[model samples]
Target chain A: MLSVVILGTGNVAFHLAKVLSSNNSVELLQVYGRNKTKLQAFEPFCDTTDNLGKLAAAAIYLVAVSDGAITALTQQLAGLDGVVAHTSGAVSLEVIDHPRPGVFYPLQTFTRDKKIPFAEVPICLEARHPNDLRLLAQLAGKLSGAVHRIDSAQRRQLHLAAIWVNNFTNHLLYIGQQLCEEKGLSFSLLQPLIQETVDKIQQLSPKEAQTGPARRRDVQTIQTHLDILEAPLQKKIYQLLSESIKSTYEKEL
Target chain B: MLSVVILGTGNVAFHLAKVLSSNNSVELLQVYGRNKTKLQAFEPFCDTTDNLGKLAAAAIYLVAVSDGAITALTQQLAGLDGVVAHTSGAVSLEVIDHPRPGVFYPLQTFTRDKKIPFAEVPICLEARHPNDLRLLAQLAGKLSGAVHRIDSAQRRQLHLAAIWVNNFTNHLLYIGQQLCEEKGLSFSLLQPLIQETVDKIQQLSPKEAQTGPARRRDVQTIQTHLDILEAPLQKKIYQLLSESIKSTYEKEL
Candidate 1:
């Protein structure tokens, strides 16, 4: 098994360490985090490190830190002889400023309790050299069936796209939950509709998948929906998104 | 099994009839629709009818017709002796234009092929009379584990909430997918994040569950995302939603 060291005790690091440990292709050499308590339970599972210097001992260092710290971490690991990579979708390869650096970003969100399988997650990879790139690709392939050589530019774009689809869309659901709560209704009613919205994209394009009055550009329904949203910011968001939907489908409609 | 007659053969009608037919509680007396082809497959399973007057035979009549024809369909079924209901969220009992009225709205998106368990769905009920309400509630209980009694006014609010959470957010996802496709990326890459955005709400409240630059109020990261949108409309959406997220988390941040 190829030996691996993962830095950070955040959700991704926690999950990646366990998953890599379970799989026969890789041996999780060390788990690192600044705060010892956060890495307490995990420490017994593998060799643990709090100091940055110890990270260089492994064949590969997976720096699963926050986006802001990735560059600094890479620079700190610059003298390390082995391959060093961060698991950030937003940051680029050149930003690494290290001897041999790349990205091993699993294109999935990680929660502390949720153990996401790497096999289903697409690993977006980039490297400075051909051999290192091939190595990263091979490592990603063991974890995931889906792997893509997304450049720094494309990775940035994916991060931005993720905000729209994940972050923004989640807030919209929050608004719905707020609206429902205000009217003495549970947010659970919206789950089925949410499932359909997702299922629609499996076959239909997003444009064709769109439903409701906004896609139809029905002002009366939009007005009614606006009336229901008492919160000023929520109302503003509702109007702005409704306008966006209208303009997208109006020409085709 | 209660004798049930379902009006219309659209998505809702097709799914409801199938679910009800599976249950020992319901025997679909007839299915009425204009499209013979749509109703053809359902003939052997239930009594399929093109005639409106023939709906008088069932113990309970469920008009799953479009919002536009809801009033007209109820008016047509007004002469029938049994209790009658419409499967519409927005339309009121008074709008049904009937002497005996109720609502049997299954609060979920219905697709022809995907068969969700009736028990998993929340059925919203409202009736003109106590006995009628009791019967509708029983029928809804038979079909779903969760049943909500919402008035016409509250139901409208629920419908509007569905528009925000379901329709509008889906359009945003569509935008994200189109943006990705424009830059030569597949929509499937966004799936895990999408599912996570939804799954988080089961444990965390939406406000507490916020992630990304907007929640952090990281203007630099937000700007980086905006630069990649490329489309003018996409930029506007990104701006509006980001501002909304900032406002939601501003005090906490």
Candidate 2:
């Protein structure tokens, strides 16, 4: 069984602790957090501690804290014998000061309230040593069906690409919601279309799935939309994205 | 039974014909297309005609053609007794020169290859006359459960909003795919993250659902991403979107 200690009380830590503690293949030794109140949730599943120095002996130490907190936490974990890993996409594995610095980044967004299926989540594993890497991979396999041995450089690239797909894409939807509110239209009306847009990409490439005035270069429709948008920033964004799409297809044609 | 005739041979027309022909409450009279080759698909299902002059007698005529062709097609349907409507989000209902001009625009994007579930699609209906509107509504009800009586101006706004949510959103995903390809990473690695991004919005508002370096004002991560992006256009897009997001949250702070 994989003996794991979770460090932090945030969304990622909560999920990891919950999944690891319940798994037949895992023996969750402890969960550490600065706040005792946040540690209460992990108390029933594993040994909870507010002191980092009192962490239990385990095969793996997962630092599931924010990016800024990772470095400081890693310094405290330098004396630990276990594979010390940070569960971060943006941060490098080298941040961990332990001899066996590793990364166990689950490439999915985690929210406090939402209960995500851990099995479907893609866990990206990385470690300096081959034995630690294999152990990390085994732990990842127990948590998820999809496990990829991604290096620090590839992980950073994946994180950047994720921002485009998740962060910027969500912002675009927010813009659409604002437009709907302005027009006295229910945002729910666009829900099906929004869902279908994502669904199309499952089968077709994003370029092949793309449709609208921007891709087609329908000048009249484009002009009408620009005239309707009152916000200068929104109009500018519309113009820039449209120009980008137009140019992309123009080069191909 | 609502006797319906579908005009054109495109994605919209094909889907409309498939759904209408199968419904017991509707009699799909004829499918008219300028291209005889495209009309062959409708021959087994309904009466197919390449000549608009020999259009079948029906209670409602759905002109599911392109926005540019709607005006010209409607001019030919001026003599018809049926309530003539065009299935276009951008074009105005007044484009149809019939005594009863109507619109039955489906809010979802349609592709020739994808077989979308017609019952779930949100149909936006608009008509000048109450009788024609009722007739169109009944026809729409047989096809889809979700129907909104959206006016021309509101429809125009919805179309624009759709571009942001579907078209521009898909383009953002395309950019993400390009980044993955450049990094020698599988684009499929981002699939789960992309799905969760959309799924989160189903329960939460886009503003509440937003999570990223830009939203949190993590200048370090944003700068790292911008520096990594080699394309000038990609970098400009990243800066503009990040700036917009940063300013949005900054106002609240």
Candidate 3:
């Protein structure tokens, strides 16, 4: 069995600990966090501690902490012989000061309130040593079906790509909800449309899947939409995104 | 059985015809389109006609043409005694010049290539006459579980909201895919993240569900992302959206 120890009792850490503890092929040794209150949530699954010195020697150490604290946390684990992987998409494997520096980036958003099935989440793995990479891969393989061996540069790009897809997309939906609230319309009315937009890209490329006034360059409709938007930010966003969409399909238009 | 005549042979008209043809309660009488080529697709399901003069009398006439063509087509159907409803979200109920003008907008993006199940689609119905509205509600109820009685003003706002959720969201995904392509990373890597973002909003409001650097106000990560984006438009979008997100949570930050 591949033994794993998860550091940092955040959303990623809690989830990793939960999944690892339940897996028959793996042993979850311990979970560490600076906050004692957060560590309590992991108590039922495995050994939890706020003290870093109490960390056990496991085959893989998954540092599921904030991006800013990743380097500092990994520096503290420099003496560990096992593969030290930080569960961050943006932060590099180089940040880990351990002899066996690695990355165990799960390319999915995690929420403490919501339970996510890790099997479908693509876990991007990277390590300086081939054996360490394989060790991390085996641990990831136990937790998820989708495991990708990605370099630091590729992972960083994926993180940036994620910001556009998840972060920016969610913000747009927030804007939609705000617009609905302003007009006293139910935001739920637009839910199916949002679902369908995501569904369309599964079969077709985003460019091929794109439609609407901006793509068609229907100037009048765009103007009508712009006129109704009360907020300056909303109007600017509408104008900018419309222009971007138009420019994207400029040749076709 | 409620008899219905469909006008226009676009994506909306095609889907409506497909659903109505199979529905036992809906007698889909005839479909009319200016282009005979486009009308041919509806021939297997119902009587297809290129000439508006050849239109048959029915309980309801659904004008499913482009927003620009909606007014002119509805004007031509002025002599029809049936309730004439244009299947458009943005267009007003007044655009239908028939004696009983109505709106039967299915609030979902329709693509001819992908077959969407109508049962879950939100059909927003509006009419000047209460009886006509009830007739639409009945028809909408037959096709979809989610039928909403909405006024023209509210439906217009919903349409605007849809542009943000569906159109703008799709554009963001397109940008994400573009970023991945530029970096030689697999676009599919980000698919799971995108799905989770949509799924999160179903349970929580978009504001409550929001995450990433912008929401956390991580200026360092935001700057790093901005530095890597080489395209001018991409950089502008990142900056604008990051600024928008920061401004949104400015009070919290």
DockQ scores for all predicted structures: 0.54, 0.80, 0.80
Worst 10 residues of 3 chain B by lDDT: B90-99
Better of 1 and 3 by TM-score: 3
How high is each candidate's TM-score? 0.87, 0.95, 0.96
Q: Give the winner by TM-score: 1 or 2.
A: 2
Highest lDDT model number: 2
Per residue, candidate 1 scores C-alpha lDDT tens digits across B153-189 of 8898888888877788788788778767777888788
lDDT of 3 by residue, A1-253 (tens): 7888898887788888888888899999899888888888999999888888878988888888888898888888877778888989887888877788899999998777777878889999999999998898888888788999998888889999999999899999999998898879888888888989999999988888887889888888899899999988778889989999999989985
Docking class of 3: high
Q: Which candidate do you rate higher for lDDT, 1 or 2?
A: 2
Can you tell me which runs of candidate 1 are displaced by over 4 Å? A21-25, A31-55, A203-205, B18-27, B31-55, B112-116
Model 3, range B1-253, lDDT digits (tens) per residue?
Answer: 8999999888889999999999998999999988988888999999888888889999999998888888877888878788999999887888776789989999998888888888999998988889999998989999999999888888888999999999999999998998888878889888888899999987888888778899888888898898999988788888888989988899986
Shift of residue B241 alpha carbon in model 2, Å: 2.1
